[model samples]
Target: MHIPFFRSFSRIREPSIAPEPAAEPAPRLGGQLERALGRTVALLQYTADSHDALDDVFTEIDGRSRTVIEELDTMRTTMEQSRQSAQDKAQASIDRLSALSQEAIDSLTQLSADLDKRMERIGAVMETIERSSSELSLLAINSGIQAAHGGEAGRAFGVLATRMRNLAERSSLDARQVAKLLDFSPFRASFTQFNTTLAHSIGDADRRISGAFHSMSASQIDMAARMDEIEAHTRAIPDMLANARDAIERGRRVLEIAQAGCAEMQNACHGPRALAAAAQRIGAPTASGVSVLDSVRGRGVLRVAIEPRAWGMSFRARGASQPRGLDIDLAQAFARRLGVAVEFVERPWLECPWLLMAGADAGAAADVMWSALVPAPIFHRVAFSDPYVHFRYVLVRRQGEARFTDIGSLAGHTLGAMPDPAVPDLLHAHGVRWGRDSLQAGVPRLKNLLIFPSLTEVFDALCAGRVDALLLEQTMAGWVCAAPDSPWSGRLEMQAAAPSDPVFHYTVGVCDDSAADTMREELNAFINGLHSVPDYGQLLKRWHIEPAQVQPTLQ
Candidate 1:
């Protein structure tokens, strides 16, 4: 009897062991199990990818929120300072205007008092003129009476007295006219009324002006108080943003936990799926074929090919058990997504792609090459994932070397570079020939070109003064010249070849085999997922990769 249930149970008990070759054929249950397992793993991976994207969005939002809060704080501080300065200026203007108004009022009052005193003196002078004219008239009348007593002799005296009397009358008339004209009683009363009205008007004007100033001061105080309230409210916005960031962080932690759970679930299905494949082999040995992804899962290890000396990308520190670099961290992250342990295979950068092309039986075969490899014509057989990081090529030279400015500056200088096809193409484009032994093809060819095997060796050549300058990647140059622990720190400087220098994209390369397409797609998904991850940027920072060296997008 062909018992299908017993066969399934037997396969599950010993998943690692292969089924006997002579075992009787069973149903196509193992093929179905494999398909189901593939679907489950795909769904879990999709979920993880979504989580990564969402986490990245949250992190961006958090960062922007912090920036907004900081800007708001700065705005609030500037507004406060401006407000105080404006208030002080306004207050000073008001005080000055008030003082000027009071001074004008005092001057007008003094002028009014002086005018009243002059009017009184003019009235007294008119009264004295009238009294003198009356006295002259009385003296003339007495002289006329004496002339009547003495006959002919008195005739001349009488004529003189008459003339004197006429003169006195004229004088009296003039004094009377002057007294009428100088009638200070009515004029003084009118002047007093005018002065009183002017004083009253000035007082009223002063009161109104004072009241207006007071009102203005009160409004300013109210406005200042309102502004204070507004500033206080503005100050609280940062705290609100902080709370939102905290919530986002908490959500991110939860998502991380969920992702971990999904990874575990995916790993748990590997055993049963392998056993199902073994059973399927018993039914039809040629029908069930393990994919590269499946093979990696079966072994519970992802072989990551890397160039250990690619500084800032992948390198092992002295006395460290594990390698540390941006590529190293990224490779480990990709391995974690597969629910497998990582096994790093060190190789030269140029030789890394060949390791992926090596067959499964090869000792140094790798599932993916995580070195900072660029897509080139030489590696046509290798499948490259989407770009994860990018950097521009730059010229690195010793400090105070004024001879080098741009790519054209390297014309008369010995330039050092590692073995890269792109390097030669770049040099050729700039009319600079590669190789020390090669004849100068042009007049302004490079003085000499030294090709080293690795980045470390190239850097050593530059440091040892064997090379005049180095054509290097921006991130690597920055790491070697700017890192505090670097021996050449502060002794070297990097300059861009040009403002429009081509950006070099770094991608993961895999063998272009039947199973490699699936692996490449998965690697691309993993790389794309890291775009929003904060740790991706932090990892680069830890490796001394500047933010400017990183590409915001895959392109």
Candidate 2:
């Protein structure tokens, strides 16, 4: 009834191997060893699972980090482009403004010279009038004295003398009024002051914009360097992931060995739960923060609001719902820059501002408004990009009609004018006196003013002989005169509203509620990028309007 453990070992002699009762202790020790091996196997398994879990976490982190890195690279590229564009735009603007300033100065100088010549001509006319009036007055006085001496025979002479004196006096008054029209000192002073102020302001703006561009370029360079460092670090995520995977592999090998030995160590006393906790504590990585751009990149769509108004900046082609215009081009460009698809929503011109301001609770909204000719007061409600186009008033007349020589000629003739904010100023600048009355409360008053609902109506009136001439902006006038199908085509010609006039600027609008500050900066950056070429002029030309350079687009 005795069995000896390790009977095959040479250390124990076969004769000494006896059926002793000590076999009980041998089995007990073997059972404890098997339990201990089982516990070791469980611990190893927990460690392997922890390593695998940690590796999976790291793999996810690596993928997300790479996505972030890619987005950062895109941002860096955008910044670089924007910086370069800003610099180019600033330089171009400086050159253009300088040239324009010089052009303005030259024009004013020429105008001054012309005025001097006209004043000389007026002086000669006044001298001739004075000589004629004095001779007539003397002849009348001599005739009157002779008439008094001749009594009844001179009655007819007396009557003729009185008429001659009256005619001479009237001619002298007319000459004095004409002389009053020769005052050019005020215009010269105003031109000088405007030129000096504009030059100084332009110089200051040039310096500021130049400095800003330089600063932005430097910032972009620094950001690019920082991005490079971050990218280098992010690129190591794969290796880190590999190491984690290798750790899991080694842990798996160890677990396999322990699993094989589990039956031999029955006396194992450690708990598997404690082992798992330890493994988790040692294997897990610290939490990585979320990336902002990554969170938003999945949308891949940009929403835009556009007004498809015909014959203006934006319009839809006939038979096609798709929009075409400067705004559409700009919006498409912006979408390309963002690497997104455009979703253009049509809205009324008056509702564009509201679309940007409205929230989803109000139904729907757009990020920004495009192709708006905003006024100064509206800036309080939203932000505006720099002007991309400009327009000025022009007086259009029928060809072969008596050419308008002066502002006085407009007094008694029927003048067709549109109800625009800039029309009154244009009229006033031409020295054409007007008044505001209850007949048309908000419209300018002229001697023979004809109010119209629209510029098209004004042009139609001129062509139909309902009005003597049409008063409209140069852009619209150009459109009308150039249109082959228009009634005024071949019959109308454009003239300046005044020798000089101010221009109306057109700009884009960003809503106050839609990250307006950032949107303004981004929009401005995009606009600055466009200044590398004369796209503004090209766009106007494509639309059959005058180039911005000739009309001079303002910021």
Candidate 3:
């Protein structure tokens, strides 16, 4: 009989029952049969035990696979939503830019028209002056000629006429120069060309942006369809596992019948003694490999990567044994959920992602990075959890300095910014020119751009007058300028009405390895849970951070 249950037992040779020899005694032959029966019964029992273990493994794998599918679905949905939001924002920005450009053109046209009207009025005045000067010259010439006929008395009149004639000539010459300078046609043509170029540029930008978003939408649709196919495959796994389990069950029943036959044969020879002893030989099966979640629980510590000088986000005070900040509190809370102690790993802002990617191979690998980091191109390799907070950039200036009121005011002034690749684009978008030493085509003309290594240095430069203004995150700016213990407290203030573009959605980062998926999920759950707790809001308020709106799904 074919025994599917014995697939894992392929290495073990089937016991052979030899036909009885004519010289062999009946009792000895019976004993041989009984011993073989006992061995077969033992093998069947081992197969059943292995089947149970295999069933458990299949169930666990099915559950994990389902969870993975659900997470992927959530990710796909979130990505679609993010893409839609970005497209909407881009469109709104494009519309605003178009409107501003049109406004500029309208204002230029009106200015040109006003200048033309003024020039016309001036020209008319010049013509009137010319006519009066010509009449006065004619009168002076006639008086000079008539005074010559009146001899000595006429000599004085001749001198007066000569003075009047000289004055008329000078007035006429001045009028002609003024009239020539009043010509506005060239100015009007230059204005028209500028307006046309601006309109063309705006239209081209609009088309490019539209095409990009259209292509992105198409790509996202394709990705979504692929994800759906993957989910369908994932959904089929449990059924496949169920069918396998049923086959194992049927094999177990067949083994049970074979075991009965073995029992009967053994009983007929040894009165159930051999079968009872065989049952005593079977031991419990060893457990399957531990999961990443179980491993973390076993270790009892969750290492969190943190940048210590992130102002209101995460930081360590002087002489303090433990670090403190909004992220610290959140990390401790996450550790509490995991039933583990929180271990803070000191790392630079840019190095945290690399450390996580190193995984267990690195001595200082982190389970999660909870610093105030935003999703940027540099961190493409890292997987990020849902955003827990949102922040925007602001223009900061020294107190009593009213020159820097908005991003537009930053033009022609030295501006301090953190060393971020996105800073240049952000500045240039707001009409501030980048001043990098290396010349690049299409780059704005250098005004003054100073990149500081850290927020501390940036603030120091602003205070020391090395930089006229600073582009900083609103939370950090508020914390530094308003915190009672801060050295910059009361010395600087944020410029009112500053543009708040490029809002940052700060999220928890982890290595992209499959091993970290469980950790990422756990973190996402923890973050989602925080919204309902009053302490979370209080923590944000304490840190001067404005809590972001929680997504409906997370809520």
lDDT of 3 by residue, 1-555 (tens): 334644534433343333333443334344434433544454454345446545654664565476567767776876777688667768876786877678787878888788888777787768777776777877777776777677674776867677787767778776776767677787778778877977787777777777767767776777776575455345435434544554465446446544444433434333333333322221110111333455568778887889888887788867778888888888898899989998898865655554453321314456678988776655544778997876667788999898877777665566777746667677666655542332566544434555544667678878877678888777677777777876788899875333346556678997554556787888889888887998888887887666434332231
1 or 2: which has the higher lDDT? Answer: 1
Clashing pairs in 1: none
For model 3, where is the 10-residue window of minimal lDDT?
279-288
lDDT of each residue in 33-140, candidate 2, tens digit only: 332333343444344444655555475566547656776877778777776777787787777788767877787787778788878878777877787777787777
Ranking by lDDT: 3, 1, 2
Q: How close is candidate 2 to the true structure, as a TM-score?
A: 0.39
TM-score of 3: 0.45
Q: Order candidates by TM-score, high to low.
A: 1, 3, 2
Clashes of each: 0, 17, 0
Instruction: State the lDDT at 483 in candidate 3.
Output: 76
- What lDDT does candidate 1 reach at residue 280? 31
| Model 1 misplaced stretches (Cα beyond 4 Å) | 1-288, 359-363, 434-442, 547-555
Cα lDDT of candidate 1 equals 0.63
Q: 1-555, model 1: which lDDT tens digit per residue?
A: 221222333233322344334443345445544443343333233334334444544454454456456756665666566666656656765675677567667866876786687677767766666666666666666676776678774776867677777767777776767666665575567667666766676676567656656765665666566554444334334433443454344334333433332333333345544445432322112133556677788889998888888877788756768876778888888889999999998865654654564311224467888887878766635778898877778889988788988777676566878756678767766666533324646546654555565677677767777678888887677788777876678888887556466667888887655556677888889988886888787777776775445344443
Off by over 4 Å in 3: 1-292, 359-362, 436-446, 496-500, 547-555
Candidate lDDT scores, in order, read: 0.63, 0.56, 0.64
